[model samples]
Target: MMYFAPYIDASGLHIPSYTDVRDQLLSDARSIFGQDIYLESDSQDYQWISVVANIVYDSFLTSQAVYNARGPSTAIGSALDIIVKINGIKRLPAAYSTCYVTLTGSVGTIITGGVVADINGYEWTLTTPISIGSSGQATALATCKSPGPITANVGEINKITTPTFGWTAVTNPGTAVTGAYAETDAQLRSRQAISTAQSSQTVLEGVKGAIAAVSGVQRSVVYENDKNVTDANGLPPHSISAVVEGGSDDAIAQAIYNKKGLGCYTNGNVPVQITDLYGVAAVIRFSRPAYVDIDVTINLKQLSGYTTQTTTDIKSAIVAFINSLTIGDSLTLSSLWGAALSANSVPNKPTFSITGVTAARHGQPLGTIDIAIAYNEVTRGNVANIVVNVS
Candidate 1:
């Protein structure tokens, strides 16, 4: 069997660990005996958290659910992973920051900068040679991101010559090579350089968007209270609070409903803020690479409540609160730095599924409630247990 204890505070229900209340309960019992010596307790009463989730049942303040259900955990390790896999799928540059690959000649070949935005991810390797002539083009494995200033010994596709002769190893240099390779034109190389630069810029946009998204989600869950910090103009810290008490279901439920009220055509569901935790499942950060990544997050918090009620009323109020919420209350995702989606690739935004709910206020359950949300990164899955006494 478990023991119960609680204390009240002005403006809200502040429940600490079970240790304090347990000692108090034992002390109260010991006081009955004039020669009070020692009191007894059990191992089950040692921990603060509950074995099973339960709600507080107090008549003074109506019950409103303070529980959330975030089903299974995604096996993602870092913030970077989440952004790349679930947030968006983008096309990266052929190589890191450099749009153009070096054209090394093997004594007689021309380098061709092909116009393509994407290729198989594994197809790119460091220092994959670039070429100028037909034979040089044959060994064209894309040279992806390389370390600091280093020239790739691409063997036969040397620098772009002035008049642009696409020279292939001549049994002779004149007309022995393929028509395309032997008669290279100056215009082609110039045009290719311009196109490559433009493509790299697009890829950057998508990466930046992903980075911004991850940063924001981290802020919402751990950052706690976010006041007028954005545009406070150096004012003192403002207030960010939620008053959940034992108020009646009538005003208590409705107060939260109106504030986070959204898409309420059917059942009453309390509104919750959802952010895209993109960096949780995909990319691994490298100190320096070809392109940069930027992630964005949309934060949400409920600032609503009613003053007079009991524990039970709060539970019903919790259900109605969720129902009144709508979807669009989020930070609009912008295309920052990215390669434009080609004919093959498209963007992947965050997808969430919230499939469960548990409630408790004074120490009893109103019942088990189940909910489904389009996004899962909205609320914390586990909540601390309730500590209640004769309050």
Candidate 2:
């Protein structure tokens, strides 16, 4: 007879079923007390054996969990947190949203420690003091008081919450750079894999890896034009173009300067100067990812157990799927069906059937064709942009 015991082999830890453990316990008891021992479900001896078997089974499960936690791919929660430290990276904490607001006031006016309010009534604290210049306006960076993905659109942050002498008005010229929640296990795992390429044999991969490891960098891509002529993307000959989202301009410039090959040209719209240890300064350029707003429409036929919450869940699922696409990743119409259906949690059957799914760029008519994304553009999705029609 085969014995059910926790064992480690080439396949890693193997755990036996509870039934097998209980049966083995009963078999051992029969041998210990003799073949004719009186033991049944109602007997005290059998009940005691069942309890012991349960304890043993739980111990085996604990052992399996411990074994899996040692590997980065299988670990989760705190275990994964510890494993990632081996790569010299810690989980990124949540960040506060920030935006630039232009302050219009009397020239030569100085304002310190001020606050601006968006239309939503959320106050954004100015990160630095502002002095009205000769042009009668000055711009200051403001950080939201509350953290985690707060956003303020252009012209929405027009209220001056902290009225200071000579500080008359405030308005954001561009949309706020939204903050991020604490990095999830999946995002951290992906980042850890990229960080290993910091010492890659290829120069391009090394440059890409170094940029990705920068603090606050959410997503990044590196493209090279090796030919003697400029490529179709307008990248110069023998140059690299890095499209990055998030992170400070100075930090990003230094990362690129550290890993790029000697005499390699960098391509981007934003330029930042980096000074070396010898006081030698070089200008490095890199692009920030452009956002392409995506609109999705999901039509579903409601089945039993479907409620209004189900529709909300379906819309959220679709929006998440769209937002998860990396820079340059095209939006496929067929993929939305699976993303929509994943919202159904009802057992045995789905709560809804997707009759049709279509997507398009914001303000355009929805269509079944996949939307093409540029190399430096990322898809942005909003829950409001998603419409779920149920019948």
For candidate 1, write residues 319-385 as lDDT tens digits: 2222112221121112100111111121242121112223322233423432222211221111112
The lDDT for every candidate, in the order shown, is 0.25, 0.87
Off by over 4 Å in 2: 1-3, 22-56, 101-151, 156-171
Encode model 2's per-residue lDDT on 145-186: one tens digit a residue: 886555576898989887888889999989998776688888
Question: Model 1: runs farther than 4 Å from truth?
Answer: 1-15, 18-66, 69-100, 103-391
The most accurate candidate by lDDT is 2
Error of 1 at 332 (Å): 22
Q: How many residue pairs clash per model?
A: 95, 0
At residue 370, what lDDT does model 2 achieve? 95
